[model samples]
Target: MKTYCFLFLIALSITQVNAETSIAILDFELNDLTLKPRTAAEINRTASIKPLLEKELKNAGYRIISIDLAMQQKANSGFGYLFDHNDVAAELGRTAGADYVLIGRLHKPSFLFAYIMGHLIRAKDGQLIGNYISETKGGDEKLTLKGVESIADKIDKDLDNRYTPPPPKHTTLH
Candidate 1:
């Protein structure tokens, strides 16, 4: 019985250690609240956030899975549909064989500032892990990139906290 229990424990630990968390990052949608027409720079800035975020998350040891563009558009159904529907996002992530899905929005409430908002959702169960936000004071590429980095940092922290294995117990030798 003792040997059986020990073997079971070892197997469980090995399973935990071997499990890799995979994520799909959808292109961030732009929510321009400002009355001014969206400029080429703002549009370009919004487009840049996803790749930077994917790179950051990949460096953090997550498996970055690509969601098919046609499928994503199909899942989106309409403008802002996928961003508003995390369940739909999760379904898309599941289709891509990802453990998590990151849906983001660059919300420009004014010309002076924008908020980078991300929703992390578990694909298996469609539960939201959290909403992470970072504020950029300017519309330049540098600041917007910084905002994406900030959101990625927050996500790493949250996921690490949630999934990190407990420290192995130290047995003392007499």
Candidate 2:
């Protein structure tokens, strides 16, 4: 009983931390392929993108904000339309009041692979901020997350830069 109580306490603390460092996850975009996504296996394969994205973001220390919360908090969810990264981040920040929002898109479909991209933007200003795009081949799940991690890492480093602005520019007459 004591051990169980300790575990529960630990889980609760982690949950609190996640809640504090909240991030909104906007919906992913999917383009229609030339042919229908047929076969149960193909359908399942096609569906793995979301799970992989969520896992990767979580692993990268981002507290994921689910669609449900986004809808409930913002009201009227997204109209199946994902805005640009900067717009998404600002809108979600106004809604969920999060520090950042990640907008993802998966387009131009092909067989045995999924090509996706993600962009992180600062909610305060509509800037490109950071971006990550990847094409995973041979149906490898690890590659999907690896791509995501690469992007996430890039965003992390950029965030650090944001706090420390670049040195003043010098324009001397030649």
Candidate 3:
């Protein structure tokens, strides 16, 4: 009986480890309030940042929901009006059956500097699980990707710390 119980416990632990968290990545808003005018190409490049973030998160072991599905759900649920509100994001996550949602903005104040800011919200209660900000010099594509990579690394670490089960305590025989 004791052997069967131990085997069952081990099986449960393995099942828990195999479960993957689902996440929804929203489109990043752009805030370029500087005097320098942005060309069409620049705006398009900025808009492309969200996919990079989604890819990074997916690579970090999260199952990322399709943005198209998220948008469709958002419109159906009347959450499109609330924009980036935490509640709205959480609702979208719920609609998509995701465990969490990631929302953020990219700000380019000038031609030389850019900032990436993001927030992770839990879908169950709309709690802010993590917030990250990264600044990188040079607003070019290479620099922007580098900045995003930095922010993604931080987010991955934060999520791992939050969701990873604590190491099991071991007992030593006296």
Candidate 4:
């Protein structure tokens, strides 16, 4: 009986571990507000953020739901469309069978640094769950990757905190 109980417990734990959260990460938009014109390197760096974020989140046990490029481009054509419209993002996530959707942007206000930002939305209800950001000092790939990693870590923590149940209250008869 004890052995059976132990085996059951192990199975339950395994099942829980296998139940990963599904998230659809949209392409990261580049919002360049700098004085200088956008360069090839800047465009390349902007393009890399989505893949890097997907990799980081996947390694953290998130099931990645890929959004089609054509659909994404078509739906989010205007400036800050996906990033600003959580409803559209949620609808897209639902269509893609994802529990959550992440819309990201790399905002460059100056030549010195840029902010990597994301909005996390609950697909079922279209609620904004979290807003995350990390600053990269320069246009280097390594620094941008680090910033992405930081945002990924924060998203993981926020999801855990929001989903975990609160401890039961203890009461004693006087």
Best by lDDT: 4
Ranking by TM-score: 1, 4, 3, 2
**Per-residue CA lDDT of candidate 4, range 1-174, in tens?**
999999999999999877889999998888898877478888899999999889888877788999998888888869898888999999999999999999999999999999999999999988999999999998998788888888887788877532222234578999
Tens digits of per-residue lDDT, candidate 3, 30-147, equal 6776776566855776687888777776776778876565474544444223345678778778877989888777777887777887888898898888888889787677767777
Compared with the true structure, what per-residue lDDT tens digits does model 1 show for residues 37-123?
577887888899999888777776788999988889878888788877889999999999999999988899998899999899999
Tell me which residue pairs clash in candidate 4.
none
Candidate 4 stretches with Cα past 4 Å from truth are 1-14, 161-174
User: Which pairs clash in model 1?
Assistant: none
**Stretches of candidate 3 above 4 Å error?**
69-84, 161-174
Lowest summed lDDT over 10 consecutive residues: which window, candidate 3?
Answer: 160-169
Higher lDDT: candidate 3 or 4?
A: 4
Q: What's the distance in Å from true for residue 110, model 2?
A: 2.4
Question: Where does candidate 1 stray beyond 4 Å?
Answer: 1-8, 161-174
